[model samples]
Target chain A: MADHAAHALEPNPTARAFCLTSAFWFAVATTAGLWAAGYLIAPDFMANIAYLQFGRLRPIHVNLVLFGFVTPGLLAAAFYYVPRLTRTELFSQRLGVLTAWLWNLTVTVGIVSLSLGFSQGREYAELVWPVDMLVVLVFALVGVNLIMTVHRRREPVLYVSIWYVFAAVVLTALTYALGNVIWRPDTGALLGIPDAILLWFYGHNIFGLLLTPLSLGVAYYVIPIVTRNPLYSHTLSLLGFWSLLVVYTHIGTHHLLQVPVPTWLKVVAIVDSIAMVIPVMAFLINIWYTARGKLGEIHADIAGKFIFTGTIWYFFVSIQGSVMALPQVQRITHFNNWTVGHAHIGVLGFAGMIALGGMYFILPKLSGKPLYSRFLADLQYWLVLIGITGFLVILTTVGLIQGNAWFNGETVYRVLPEIHLYYVLRLSAGLAILSGAYIGLYNMVRTLFFNPGVQA
Target chain B: MIQRMTPTAVILGAVAILSAVVFVVIIWPNTTVDMTPSEIFRERTAEEAAGRKLYIANGCVYCHSQSIRAFDWGHGATRIAQAGDYVQDEPILLGSARTGVDLSQEGGEHPDDWHMAHFINPRWTRPNSIMPPFEHLGMENLRLLTRYIQSLGMQAADKRMQRQAFWKQASTKAYEAGIEANVRWLSETVPQGWRDIPTPYAASDYSLARGRMIYQGFCIGCHGPVGDGMGDAQPHIYPPPLNFTILKGRGISGGLIYYQVMNGITGTAMPYFKKELESQKIWDVGNFIAAYFIDELDANGPPRGIDAAYEP
Candidate 1:
C-alpha cells in the first residue's frame, strides 16, 4: 500500500498518536449519534430510560459531534501539519496526549451528566457550569500547545493553516466564556432581553467562529497537499479569514431579528448577514482556484473527496444561513425546524464532513499502516453523505410546513400531523450517520492495534 | 496530457450563471404578496406611524405575521387578509416566527387597554407567552405600538375596536356598580344552559395533574402562577388577566370555560389556544384553573351521557 512508502518516508510518533486519538473519538461520537437517532425514531423505543430521552440525547448527539468527533479529528490533522509545515517536531507529544485524554473525559462527563438531566437548560450551552469550565480549560491548553509549537518553529513563514487553528482556539475560548455566561451561576442569564441577545450572539458564533474556522483550516491544509499545488491566492485566503471574523462577529443579532432588541441592532445583523456573501465567496474562490485543474486528484483521494464535498455544503449552508437571517425570510424559518435543519447541515454536513476527511487523511500515516478496511471507510463515508443530505431535505421541508401553517393562522395542533412524518424521517437519517460512526471506529481500532503488520 | 477546465474558469462560469438565474428567477419579480387597503388602514396617525417604525425596527415581524389566508380559519379565523391591504407598504411586515400569536387581523381583537398590558409583558395578559417585553419602548410608545397592532386588520380591526369600546364602557359601569352587578354582568353574557353544565372529566388527580402541566405550558405565562390573570403578560393586557377568583360561586360552567379557552376573548390578549394545544390539553388546563385557582370543580360524579358503544 502507498501508506508503507509514506511511512518509510517519515517516521513521526507524535503525528501517529494524534491520528489514533482523533480516530477513537470519531468512533465514539458516531455511536452516540446513532443512539440519538434511534431515540428520535421511537421515543418510546427506549422507554422507561432516563438517559435516552429525546431532549437529553439530542444534545449528546450535537455536543459529541462537535467536540468529540469533529474537533479532535481536525486538531489531529493540525498536530501533524503544524510540525510538518514548520519543519520541526511537535512541541510536546506529552501535552498533546494529555489534551486528547482530557477532551475525551470531558465528552464522557458531558454525555453522562446531560443524560442524567443535569443540564443548565441553555441550547448549545447545555453543559453545567463545571463542564463548561473544563471546555474552556481544554481550549486554553490547546492554544498553549499550538502557540508554543509555532513559537519554536524552524520555518519563518506562518502558513494560513496555522493562522486559522490559532484564531479558532483563541476566539472560541473568549466566545464560549461570554456565551455560557459563566459569571451567572444560578440562571446563566442577565435578566431579560439582554440575556436573550447575549445568548444567541454566543450561540451563532459557536458555529461561525469555532466550527467554521477550524473546518476551513483543515480544508486549506488537505486540499493543496492532495492536489500537489500551492494555494491560488494567499491574499484571497487571508481576505476570507479576516472577512469571516469581521462579518460573522456582529451577525449573531440575526438570530434575534424577531425579538424586541433595539431596531438598529437588527439592521446591523441583517446588513452583515447579507454581506456574509463576500467572505463566503472569497473562501470558495480561493480554495476552488487552488485546486484548479485537479479534479482527478480530488476524486482520487478519499480525504480530498470528503473535504471538497464539505466545501460545497458550506456554500449552501452559509447562503441558506444568510437568507434565513433576513427578517422576511426568517418569518418562515425561525422558531421552526428550518434553523434546526441549518444547525445540522452546518455542524454535521459542513464542519463534520471536513473533520472526517482530516481524520482519514492522517490515520494511515499515523498508524503506519493502510486502513484496516478501505471498503469500510468508504462505506461509512457514503452513509454519512446520504444521511446528511437526507437530513437537509427532510428538515427543510418540515420547517416550511410549520412556517406556512403558522403564517396562515392554522392553530399549532393542526400542523402536528403534517410534521410528525418528517421527524420520523430525521430519526432514520440519523441512523445512517450513526452506522458510519461505528464503521469508522472499527476501522480505526483495527488499524491502530490489530493490524497484522510490523512497524517499520 | 489531461484536458481540464481551470478551477478559476469553472467557478467564474458557475457564479455568472447563478447570478443571472437568481436575477431572473428570484429578484426581478415581486417578492412580497400584495395586501389591500381598507378605510381604517388608509392612513396611520403620526404616533401610529412612529409605532409602526418601532415594530419594524424591533424585528416584531419575525414573530408576528401580518397576513392571514382562507386556510387560517381553523384558528378562529378572522377575515383573511387581502393583497390590497398591503398596497401602502414598503417592505411589508409579514413576519415569520411564531413565538407569539399571529397578528394579521389584530385590529379590535382587544381593547387598547389589553394591548398595553400585553406589550409590556406578554405573560401578564395570557400567561405562557415567550414574547419578549417591549418595556424599553416605554409606556408612551408601548401605547402607540398597541394602536398600530390593533390596526393590523384595518376594517375588521375597527369593528373589533368598536366592540372593545362598547365593552369597556359596560365593564367600567359594572365594576363601579359593585361586585354583585359586575359578576352578574360577566355571567349574563353566557347563555343560561352553559352556566349550569358541570365539567365532564370529574377533576380526578390524574386529570388535574395533566391540567396543571397544560396550564404551565400554555397559560402560566399570562395567567399568573396563581391564576390571578397576573401572568407576565398581565401588564400588557387589559381589562387585565381575567381574575378567576371573581367567578367564585358565580355559577361558571365547564362549557363556558371550554368556550372561552377555545375561542379567546377578543379585544384582550387571551389568545385562542385551539391551534397550539389539543382538546384534551385545553380541558385539562380548564379543570386545573377550576380546581386549584378558583377552588371550583364541577368535573365530578358518574357518567351522565348514554354511551354510544354501550347498550342501555
Candidate 2:
C-alpha cells in the first residue's frame, strides 16, 4: 500500500472513448455557434433554411456545448481520475463505455430532433420528452457506475475532487429531471411562472453544480499536481464546497428580477447571488495559495496552463455575476448582449477552458503516450482565450449601447444599425473559437489513435 | 466534513441541497403563483395555438419580446406585462431580447396584409427593421404566424378586429359606389375640423420632394408609384387600395388627406402613420397628393398660419 499506487497505470478505455466523443462534438457545437453568430450579423445569411435558422441553431449550439463538448470533456477526465483517486478499478468499464455510446446517441438525437422542429421550448430544457428521458437515463448510468467504484474504494479518505465528481453527477441528474418536469411528460412544464422558476433553478445549476464543480474539481486535482505542491488546506476546501452548495442553488431568480416575480424571492436570489463571493473567494484563495509563485511550473504543463487560466476566469466570471445580479446592474445587463458576454466567459472562458485542460491532461495518461502535438493544444488555448475575451468586450459594448438606447425612447430599429458592426466583430471572433475547436479535435483524434510520440 | 464523507453520505448531502433549493425556488413559486388569467387573456384558438408553435419552432421569440416591463419605453411601455396574461400558455414565451420590436401588444397593430408583406420582407413596411424575413414559412405558415401575432393581446385583439371589420365594410362599399360617392364618404368620415382645416404650411418644392420620399418608403406597396391604387399589395388587400384619381375634383380637402393618412382608414389596406410619421411629414405628403393627383390648391391658399420652417 504505497502512496504511488494512487496513480492509475492501466489504460482507461471508457475515458478514451469519451475523449473522442468530446472532440467530435466540440467541432459540431462550434460550427453551430458560428452559424448563430453569422445569423446575427445578417439575419438573412442562412435565411429561409429551416434547420439552419438562428433560432434552431442557437439551441443546438447551447445544448451541444453543455452535453456535447464541455460535459464530455470534463467526464473524460473524471472517468480516468475517479478510479485512480478511489484506488479501485472502474466499477465496470463495459458499463462506462456503454454510457459513452448512449451519451453520444442522446446528443445526436437531440440535434436531429431540434433540427426537425421538436422542442419543449424551455431555455435549458429544450429537449423533447423522449430525448429528455434519454438524458436522464445516461446521467443515471454514469452516476451509478461512479458511485459503485466509490463503494469499493481502497482509499480511506475521499479526496475533494472525488467529492466534486459525485456532486456534479448526482446533482445534475436530479436537477435535469425536476427542471425538465419529466413527470408530466406531455408539455414538460408547470403552469406559467412556476415553470420559469423550475427551469432556471435547473438551468443555473446545470452550470453551477455540473460545470463549476467539475471544472473546479479538475483544477483542484491538476493544479497542485502540476505545481508539485500539496493542497493549501483541507479546511478551506471544505468551506468552499459547502458554501458553494448553499449559495449557488438559490440565485436562479436573479433572472426574473425585472419581471413581476415575488419580491421576497427576488431579494433572496439577489442576496444569495451577491453572497456568492464567500465560496468564490474561498475557492480562489485555496487554489491560488496552492499554486503561488509557481507560474513557470504551471505553464510548463499545457493542461496546467489551461486549468490555471480557468481559475482566473472563474474569478472574473464570479465577480461579474455577483455584480450583475444587483437589481440596478441587471437593469442594464439583463436580457442583453452583456449577459451574452458574461455567459461566453463563464461557459467558454471558465468551464470550457478547464474541460479542455482536463481532456488534454488525461489524454496522455489514457493513451499511454505523450501528447502528440503540444503546439496544437497550446495554439487552441490562445485561440479560445482571445476568441472568448473578444466576445466579452464586443458584446459588452453592444449591450451597453442597446440597453442605453432602450432606456431612452429609441426604437429597436434605431439601435440595429448601431450594433451591426459589433455583430460582425462577434462573428469574426467566433471563427477563432470555431477554428480552435476543429484544431483540438484533430489533436485529440491523433493523440487517441495516431500519436507518433513516445510512450509515457 | 466533505472529505470525511463516504460516497453514499456525500450523495445524500447533494440530494439534500438539491431538495432544499427545489422547495424554496420551485415548490414555493408553484403554490403561490396566481392561476387566474388576466382580464385581457383568453384561451387560444386552435389556429392561434398552431401559430404559437410555429412562432416557437421558428425562433421568432429569440428576437421579439412578449413581456413589456415598467421602464421599457417606446411601444414596450404601451402595456405593463402582467403575469396572469400567460396562465393559459403552456410555455410562456416572455422572451429576453428586443432585436426587433416588442410584440406583447402587437396584435392588430397592422392589418393582415401588412404583416404578410412584412413577413415576406420586413423592409416592405419598415425600411430599417433588422427582422429576418419569414418568407420561407410559406403562405400557410405565415397566415398561422399572423393569427398568433394578432392574438397576442387576446381579448383586446378581438375588440380591435371588431372595429376593423366594422369599418372595412363601409370603406369597401364606398369604394364600389363610384368615385363621387367615395370621395364624399372619405371626406365625411374625417372629423369636421380636419376636413375644413387647410394645411398651415405652404407647399414648396422641398415639401413635395420630402413627401415623395416618405410615400415611397411607406405607402408605395399599396398606393402604387402613380397613386392609381394598383400597388403590389392590391391582390392581398380587400376593397383594393383607394384610387387617388377618384378624389380629384370631388372636393378632396388637404385636411381630409392629412386625417386619413394620420389615423388610417381601419379595415382597408391603409395603415396609420401616426406612430411612424411626424405632423409635418403627414401634411407634406397630403399636400403632395393634393397637388399631383387632385389638382387641388388648399395649401397654396389661405386658412393657413405661419409656415413651418424646413428643419422644424
Q: Which candidate is the best by TM-score?
A: 2
Among all windows of 10 consecutive residues in model 2 chain B, the one with the lowest summed lDDT is B303-312
Report how far off residue A38 is in candidate 1 (Å). Answer: 4.8
Query: Can you list each candidate's DockQ?
Result: 0.06, 0.52
Runs off by more than 4 Å, candidate 2: A1-10, B1-3, B73-76, B175-188, B192-235, B239-262, B273-312
Against the reference, the lDDT scores of all candidates come to 0.70, 0.84
Residue-level error in angstroms, candidate 2, position A230: 1.8
List, residue by residue over A1-456, the lDDT tens digit for candidate 1.
011135432444555555565566656666666665554344335443545644456567677777777777778788877787777777888887788778778888987887776665555676877898899998998888877887787776767777677777877787788778789765454433445455666677788778888889899888988888878887787678767777777677687665445566678778888999988999899899989999899887888988999999999999998888877787777767787788878887898889888877877777677667778878988998999999899989988998778777566545654666787898788778778877877887787779875555
Displacement of the residue A67 alpha carbon in candidate 1, Å: 1.4
* The 10-residue segment with the lowest total lDDT in model 2 chain A: A1-10
Candidate 1 CAPRI grade? incorrect
Candidate 2 versus truth, CA RMSD in Å, comes to 3.5
TM-score of 2: 0.91
Worst 10 residues of 1 chain A by lDDT: A1-10
TM-score for chain A as predicted in candidate 1: 0.94
